[model samples]
Target chain A: MTAITVDRLHKTYLVPEREGGLRAAVGALVRRRRREVHAVTDVGFTIEPGEVVGFLGPNGAGKTTTLKMLSGLLHPTSGTATVLGHVPWERDRRYLGQMALIMGQRNQLQWDIPVLDSYKLNQAVFRIPDADFKARVEELSELLALEELLRKPVRNLSLGERMKCEIAGSLLHAPQVLFLDEPTIGLDVAMQRRIRSFVAEYNRRTGACVMLTSHYMADVEALCRRVIVIHHGRLLFDGALEELVHRFAGDKTINVELADEHPLDPAALGPLVDGHAVERSATGFSVRVPKAETPRVAARLLAGLPVSDLVIEEPPIESVIEQVFEATSAEVDGG
Target chain B: MADVATRPVSGRPDFSKVSFGALRRYYVGEFGASTANNLAYRGAVAIWVVTTVIQPMVSIVVWRTVAGPAGEVNGFTSAEFVTYFAITMLVDHLTFIWLMWEFEWRIRTGAMSPLLLRPIHPIHKDVCDNLSYKVIGLVGVLPAMVLLVIGFGGDVSGIGVVQVLTFLPALVLAMAVRFLLEWVLALSAFWLTKVSALNNLYFSLFLFLSGSFAPLAVLPEAVRTLAHASPFPWIVSFPVEVALGRRTGAEVWVGYLAQLGWILVALVLLRVVWRRAVRVYSAVGS
Candidate 1:
């Protein structure tokens, strides 16, 4: 079943533009210049229950704006989104009860109090039956290893520890959907890995639908098999990560190890393969070819060189991401 | 997963346990923690309390001087005037609510978003914080209040045990009425980014109309009528009147009835305002 459906979502903001210097500042009091920014434009997607989808975008590319609309923190200027068969922006108590939004940069925990007290306070707000509240808190504490941190003031906890508590607090009600906005931001590698695995475990146990937005590819690669790339307020691609690479990217690199030094010039090779080739050593060079032409290029390269070892590998995902943005910008400039 | 830290305890309890037991555990420990917090900030709290209390004290001195050599002015003897303002000081301190300022800060700092997401209305936490401060500050303020009354040479001979006992409920209701009313006003923070000027204007009007300056009866009939129509007089002056035995029979009944009316009005206003305010906040990003 579909847990979420967002159709043609659009959000526009009227932001005031301020001019520098005393004269403009004084004039702004009487008249202000306003510009409209379309943060999300004609975006649409759906998530099935238990599906983990990564939302990839650059800063100011409307990732957070989209998440805010999905979580009902914002009202869209146009179009609609429904989570668990209810319109999110209506923010019905039932919907809020069944969903949770966690932002990495913002904290929901009370600064001066123990984490347990804040959790208890949430129990009252959610009106969770005491028995259920206690059982959930104990379970979360064990899952997140929060036994030691529960009694200490949140201010005393390190960033990583605090993030764990924050995550645990949000799940006290066992929400069916999670909207995570850069959840691993600002944490060290070890902490990030721990949180990532914990989330994967939680999703496996609960089968909760998750929409994750993050700049870290590690987080996306670890948690999401499918990713939707957005830029300039538009959805660029949506499918499995491998499909994304296949659709927008060229193919593999043929890395060759030669037995002895040989004078080889990449330009001397025919057609130049329309890609990059580099020497790893005096006799070693890597030649890249489109996936469709890999066999033909390998035949020529192998016949032409005294190669001892050869390995072909898919290009790195980071390069593909950079190339995707470059292609998008080229399209815009060409238009 | 079977080797969980503890057995899944049946967290449910009977109805009695939910209401009394939960509040008891929260308040008892919360009270201790709040006392320690207050002690840590005693220097700042003392300064704030002194500044706030001195406003009433200054009003007493000014009214006493206005009465001059004559024993009575505007139906109140100089000594009675002293008693009135002294009682006003204590009542005002106890009844004053800062939810307006708190809500303004909470909304502006985006703190209200987290509070809203919580299952409880943020007011419950504020209630605990307020009650805890009163308990902690009572140690210092109670003695000082008695000293001021004695030093001013006021006539409190009519304040019997019954009036003293009646004062407690009157004060608690006054606090409730003030909290709800101010909380409704604080919702204005959602719509208006700058509400401090509005707050100052509201308190300034309350000062003149509520007999914080002098007995409402002493004010012109026009202002007194307005005060009676509003909740200001019931919140401050009614409690003082009951404590000083100024109201009897029908008057006491009417005073209690008026407080109930104000409570209803406040409750309705809060519901209406809170819904609209949350709608507005949710419409805009926090």
Candidate 2:
């Protein structure tokens, strides 16, 4: 079953135009000028039940705008979207009860109260029974290691600890669909890994559909198997993570380690790989080759040089995503 | 993505239709939580109490000086002025709604987004918070009322049981009228960036028209007539007058009827304004 279906979703804002200095301020007082800003345009995608999809995009690329529309915090300027068989913008209570939107920077918890108290409030808002609420709290606490943190006021907790509590609080109702926008934006690597693992485990246990947006590539790599790339308010690619790498990442790096520490001539390995430069190091040299020619290039390197070890690796997912965005920018510039 | 079966999760309730019992439970929980949250800010409440107490105390002193110890002004003796201002303090404390200031902060800070995503309407939480603040504020207000009565020698010997009974409904309706009307006004923050000037203008009008500065009869005939034409007098002065036995029998009933009328009008205005405000917020992005 489809957990979410968004088709041709668009959001345009009428921003008041103003310039600095007294003259423009006085002019604005007499008659305000507004300019149309298209935050999201013609965005379309679908997420199946139990699927974890990464929403990848650069800044101001409408990733957050699209998530807001999916979560019903925004109404599309003109388009349609449905989550769990309900139109999102209609904001049916049933739909809201079964979905949770967690913005990493925005907090839903009452600042002055204990985290557990906020969770209890969510129990009331979502109408969770006492027994179920207790059980879920215990379970989430254990998963997030939140036993000690729950009793402290939310403002007293650090960002990582607070984020863990936030995730736990949002899940008290066991929402069937989760929309996480930059769920690990400022956390350290360990905390990010922990959150990623917890989300994967949650999905495994409950089979909830998750759509996550994050600037951290490790977050996407750890939690999501499928990714939906968006740029300029349009869908660029939507498929498996490996497929994204393969399609957008045209070149693979080949590292060759020689038996002895010696600097190698760049021209020696130039013909083996393409005309790409060979980066020399103390014990090894690395070269870039086309995805399809990596194997041939490695074979040639092993036969042509005193190579002790050789490794071929796909470029990092971050570079691939950057290339995707850069390619889009180039297309816009060229067109 | 492959198609998956639509299996209903266990232990999930049918939230499409919320029952009254569940809603009551939710409200009770929200009220309790809000009350606890307010307790954490006792210092802030104390500061607020200083302002709340001083406003009425200053008004009473001015009216008492105007009435002179033995003389009466606008049919209000010095003692009657003390009673009226003391009761007005309590009545004002109960009916005041600060959403005009709070709503602007919520919009500017993007705090309204989480509220918008919730299954319940955001007003329920605000109602709970408002009630909780008033309930906690009474701790400070009661002492202030006692001090004012002791210091000013307020005499309530003329206030009978019937007037006391009648004041209860009037106070409740006045709170409703003020909350609903001010909530409608607070929606202006959705369209305007700076609502402080608007809020200040509103509070100024309310201060003069609601008898906070002085009882309506003490004002000029034209201004008193204008006060009666607006909902402000019905919100504060009517309840204080009922408590003071200044309005009796049929007059009390008329006050209730007028309050109910203003409440109905405010309710209609709140509904219209809230819908448009949400539409604007959704369009502009919270």
Candidate 3:
């Protein structure tokens, strides 16, 4: 079964608007004004069971809004969505029990008590039996490295520790669907990597469908094979992560190391890569060419130069996503 | 890697069906957690009890001045004045909820996101939190009540078996009515960014109409009639009046009816407003 099926899901909010200064404030007493913000519009995608899909978007690009709609925290202004065959907005207990929404900025754990106690509360709320709760807690504790954290109050833990404990607490229910919005936000690089790996392991162990949205592309690259990109409240692209990269990256970077350790000049290897400049290094040269021209460029470089090693790689996902956002924004603004 | 059928999830015991055991377990678990949370800030709970004690003591002193010369005013002795304020203070403590003050902050700060994500209705957590505060607060309040009765000479002369027995149930119902009423009002934060003004209006009406300001008998007749139109008196004053043996026979029954009526009304309003409030919240992005 498809873990999630969203069809033309849309959401809009009426935001109160007012101008600065006392005159406007005084006039506002007599009347109020508001503007409609279309947060997510006609965004549609299906995430298969056990798939870890990345929801990629720039700020105000409706990634969180779509996640909220799927998690049952918000209702769409139009269209429909379902997770595990149940409409999310209905907030059915069956659906809720099978899913978890973990926001890095928000905590679901009780702050004043030990993380273990908070898990106990969840156990009762989720109706997990005593033996199962103990075993699950142990498993999550081991996975999240929460041995010391289980006894410590959430307030007492450091940011990374608390976030780790928070993630562990969210997963105690072993939800089949997880919506992780910036789950690695504000953490150190190492902590972020730790969280990403924990998510991957959890996904592997439980077969839960995971949809993650992160400003850190590393988080997505580490876990998601498929990605859905949205911009200006509209779905811009949806496909495999590699395909997204190829479609939007526009260029592929090729780095070559000369067999001899002499510095190479850019013009020496130029006119080979569509007149594009090559950046020379002590070891070799590096150049970026159009995505379609990557193979030809790499071949020409390897055959033409005393190349010891040559590697062709797609541009980073961040640049690709940014390009997607900027292009869509331009089209939206221009139109 | 996505096969949880063997390690499948468990749905919490839903309350759609009547099951006392499940109800007891859930409430007890929540209550324990809430109690632990409250205990973490024992100083705050202590300070809260102090604030609760101050208002009634002030009211008692003011009313005592009115009965100065003869120790009696409007057919009531000075002792009765003390008793009235004392009971009002206790009832007020039992029924008051602070969510109206916190709801605006929660919505603005995005603190409400956690609660909304949970499977259970948020009210149950709030209810347990309220109960935990009261239970912990009673440690300070009960002794204070005893001392106030002894220090200020509060009379227990009219007290009897029936009054105390009936007061218990009325007090419980009043707490329910008041809690639900305030929670419904707290939902106003969904639309308004600041709720302090609305909360201030609510408190002022409650003070005036609920007999916390003065006994209905001593207040003007028109005000008494107005008090009947609102749930404030039923939540705070009527319970106190019952405990004092002031309301008798059909009057006692009428107060019960009013308390029950308010609970039902609050329940209906809570359901309707809560439904709309969630829409507003989703629209507002908190």
Q: Which residue segments of model 2 deviate by more than 4 Å?
A: A266-275, A292-300, B1-8, B283-286
Q: Kindly list the per-residue Cα lDDT of model 1 for residues A1-335, writing each as its tens digit.
A: 68999999998877789878999999999998999989999999999999999998778778888987887667788998889998887766667767788988887876777888778766654556666777777777777789999999788999999999999988877778898989989999998998899889888877888889887888988999999888878999989998887887786888888777676666665454444555456558787777888877777767877878888887877778778988887897899
Task: Give lDDT tens digits, candidate 2, residues A1-335.
Answer: 69899889888988889999999999999999999988788888888999999998998889888888888777789988889999987788889999999999998898988888888889888888787787788888888899999989999999999999999999888889999999998999899999999899888888899999999999999889999988887889999999999888998999889988656767766776667778877788888778888888888888888899998899989988998999999998899
The numbered model that scores best in TM-score is 2
Q: Could you give candidate 1's per-residue lDDT for residues B1-286 as a string of tens digits?
A: 6332222223423322236555555555455555555666788778867766677678778878888646677678777877888888787877777878887887777677666654335666777778877766666566667766888777797699989888777888888888888888988998886699999999999998778888987888899988888889988999898888887668877878888889999999988887778666632342
Which stretches in model 1 have alpha-carbon errors above 4 Å? A32-34, A127-135, A250-311, A322-335, B3-47, B68-73, B217-230, B282-286
Instruction: Flag the better candidate by DockQ, 1 or 3.
Output: 3
Angstrom error at residue A8, model 2: 1.0
Ranking by lDDT: 2, 3, 1
Give the per-residue Cα lDDT of candidate 2 at B220.
97
Taking the candidates one at a time, how many backbone clashes does each contain? 5, 1, 2
Candidate closer to the true structure by TM-score (higher is better), 2 or 3:
2
Q: Native-contact fraction for each model?
A: 0.10, 0.46, 0.42
lDDT of 3 by residue, B165-265 (tens): 99998999999998999999999998887899999998898889988888878888899899989888888888998999988899989989888998999
